[model samples]
Target: MKVNPTTLSWQAPTTNVDGSLIDYELEYEVGIAGDSTEGDYAPLATIPGQLRERETYVAPIADLPLDHGEHTIALRSFDKAQPDRMSEWSEPVTFMLATVPERPLELRVT
Candidate 1:
């Protein structure tokens, strides 16, 4: 994805019977199919209050375990009433981790 993970936001699932969603868990692995497990994937943030259809996760870059390179991102919705009861993780999203490019200097017209 071209968008930044730190600024990434997603919508909640409607076709789930996992009661009410409490939080949206964002996890990521270093490489493709690296691992989506709790230990393998470093949890970025756990967003609470699932009242809104969508939410924006403010995960600082410093929180990310990976500094750079391709990675896999996945999301899981946790049940509100029951913490253990949660929905399955959504399909993984392929993303590239790179440093923000510096701004150009000395602009000139051709």
Candidate 2:
């Protein structure tokens, strides 16, 4: 996955089964972990497309709220042909958005 100033792009995985290619159902969720299994996790977005060939997919960063501190982003991919089948979720991508701090210092010479 590639993270830019305002976007996250990555190549979708292509899985072949039988003799046909499978479509990809991309889903993402973002939230912060509170306790170990509890947090305000909400579905951020879902992008569906056909994995006909090797290509790159991008998710705009503008959609996400850029708050200070660390944030967790999760992504999942599923087969379009088999709705019930899903691939193992990719590693959760964590990003930190921090504001530049200002410093006030002065030097004195005698």
Candidate 3:
């Protein structure tokens, strides 16, 4: 069985709500659902925080279940200094997976 995984990426928040630079490591919580809006989301992944010069974050959904025709993915981040506090879920990204058509059985020369 072949699978087509989706690569999701986002940049971390560089400043706090007060405009102060974020000096702590940040973790992320990812969720997935079958609707474009409104519904409970299933927990997808909890990415550990990493200190990096670039604040960009990338996550690949390799084992994403494709039972539904459409799917929505979302995620939030929190500073490791306070795990209990987390930012609201980012805007959901809706997408669908498509498979290539089967090859033709036969071909004839013109």
How high is each candidate's TM-score?
0.55, 0.53, 0.67
What residue runs in model 3 are displaced by over 4 Å at the alpha carbon? 1-5, 34-42, 51-55, 63-68, 98-110
Report clashes for each candidate as comma-separated counts: 0, 0, 0
Off by over 4 Å in 1: 1-6, 18-44, 50-66
Q: Which ten contiguous residues of candidate 3 have the minimum total lDDT?
A: 61-70
Report how far off residue 84 is in candidate 1 (Å): 0.7
Better of 1 and 3 by lDDT: 3
TM-score of 1: 0.55
lDDT for every model? 0.52, 0.55, 0.71
User: How far off is residue 18 in model 1, in Å?
Assistant: 8.0
What's every prediction's RMSD, in angstroms?
A: 5.9, 6.5, 4.9
Against the true structure, whose TM-score is highest? 3
Distance from true location, Cα of 54 in model 2, Å: 7.7
* Best-to-worst ranking by lDDT: 3, 2, 1
Candidate 1, poorest ten consecutive residues by summed lDDT: 25-34
Candidate 2's TM-score reads 0.53
Q: Which stretches of candidate 2 lie over 4 Å from their true place?
A: 1-4, 16-20, 23-42, 48-54, 79-84, 101-110
Q: Pick the candidate with the highest lDDT.
A: 3
lDDT of 1 by residue, 1-110 (tens): 65446643556554446565434442322222445454244455455543243353333444545558776766666655566755556566766777788799999999
